[model samples]
Target: GIKGQSLPDHYEIDSSKAKKDLGITFIPLKKTMEDLIVQLADLQTMLEQS
Candidate 1:
């Protein structure tokens, strides 16, 4: 939301090599949901304050 031109309608990431390079596995579903809920709550709080 900076006072400038906007981004293009497309984007890309070369994450196909992430697993091989980082040695990481899938995220646990429960933890992922918890984190998302926390983030959404934080955003909602900020919106209300603003």
Candidate 2:
């Protein structure tokens, strides 16, 4: 039996206004995750050096 339970997903932010008013571009989830990983790694390295 599975111990962990899955929670229902929801959207917190409305993207339509960002696109129409702010001219923000949507990034793919995969690419966004990759970029976050890289940023975290860099931050860790900086912390270790300090």
Q: TM-score for every candidate vs. truth?
A: 0.53, 0.53
lDDT of 1 by residue, 1-50 (tens): 67797997998866658878997677889999999999999999999999
Scored by CA lDDT, what does every candidate get?
0.88, 0.91
List candidate 1 stretches off by more than 4 Å: 1-22
Candidate 1: minimum summed lDDT over ten consecutive residues — where?
A: 11-20
Residue 10 shift from truth in candidate 1, angstroms: 30
Error of 1 at 26 (Å): 1.8
RMSD of each: 9.6, 8.3
How good is model 2 by TM-score? Answer: 0.53
| Per-residue lDDT over 1-50 for candidate 2, one digit per residue giving the tens place of the 0 to 100 score | 45696755964877999899999999999999999999999999999999
Backbone clashes in model 2, listed as residue pairs: none
